[model samples]
Target: MFNMILRVTENPVRRTTARDIAIIAVFAAITAALGLLPAIYLPVSPVPITAQTFGVILAGAVVGGRRAGASQLLFLALVALGLPLLAGGRGGIGVFVSPTVGFLIAFPTVAGLIGWATERVGAPYRLLPGLVVNTAFGIGVMYLFGWVGMMATTHLAPWAAIVALAPFLIGDALKVVIATLTAKGVHASYPGLLRSRTARAVAGAA
Candidate 1:
């Protein structure tokens, strides 16, 4: 009976088209929900510290590069439509014009990059390695867009722009560490939960 149950649990027959859609939708909703968490306002800047970093990293780790990027793009689209879905319930096209806008635009690309990198690592998960890669790539993406956006939108000189961004750097690094650990934990617990595409390919072959 134990062997039979194991066979049933591992049955490839469980894979289905609807299942893939449902899984992706669920992860997308999770990403959005993480965005809605309360934020810590920074008096120095309009940018607020929020759990959205978790959402961003989770997208890459759980959904892989392509769907992860798609999920972030969907979230951005919602924001563009004037939904108060961003940090501190702020959103709209106007937000895109703000100094923090570059960070917003970098979200999808960072997710894709992290996802792609993690996939290349080819392991269950290693916290230090994941943390290092994610911290570098995620922060690099944010700063690249953020500095340019700040320079374009605000009166701050280059040094001031660097100063404005400096305060958030440590916090962002902490978030990256948290995200890396979270991803590793989820991966260990649910080995194949994120394999919707792979399952589909196998199902097609069968």
Candidate 2:
């Protein structure tokens, strides 16, 4: 049962290795560092454009589903513990009640979803599918949760959240593309960064 929980896909013994743990920690730090970038706030929107999501997207692509989720959860746990790792240096328990709370809560889910998508789509392919997959799950599901959070916290109508999110569409698309390309490149160059299903099976056999 524990193995089932830890399996990246079908193989259970993939690695509770130091290497896997290191990748998770490094990616968590990467997300925090990216969050330190100055956010670009549009006059009309409450959420700002920040680089943290770039790390969020890449974490899944590079680390696979389980490790990616761990990295994101670790980042969130630190923020909740007053690490000041969020965008604009805000942190602690108060963050869960903010207007942007939905996005904050959904961060781990986003990384997991992206990693799951990457695992299924299979890498080293033509990237258009990855772009589509990332955009669908990453941008689409992300905002859906964010929109729900906005309405819940801000007491706004559904249309208000939908309307406000309009400014972010283009930039997020670009992010999806960048994340897909970068992840694929990393996979091609260093296949061991994450073991594909085939790769894992082969390793297990030998």
| Candidate 2 wrongly placed segments (more than 4 Å) | 1-15, 40-47, 196-206
Predicted candidate 2 versus true structure: per-residue lDDT over 1-206, tens digit per residue: 96885575564545577677788888999999988989877665565778777888888777778889899999998888999998789899999998878887777888998888777766443378777777887898888888999999999988888887777776677678888888778778877655346875677679
User: Model 2: which ten-residue window has the lowest total lDDT?
Assistant: 6-15
Per-model TM-score versus the true fold:
0.76, 0.79
Task: Name the 10 consecutive residues with the lowest summed lDDT in model 1.
Answer: 9-18
63-146 per-residue lDDT for model 1 (tens digits): 677667767877788789888877677788999888888888888888888878777664556788688778777787878888
- Candidate 1, clashing residue pairs? none
Cα lDDT listed for each candidate = 0.76, 0.80
Prediction 2 global C-alpha lDDT = 0.80
Instruction: Name the best candidate (by lDDT).
Output: 2
User: In candidate 1, how many Å is residue 126 off?
Assistant: 1.6
Number of backbone collisions per candidate: 0, 0
Residue 191 C-alpha lDDT in model 1: 82
Each candidate: RMSD? 10.2, 7.3
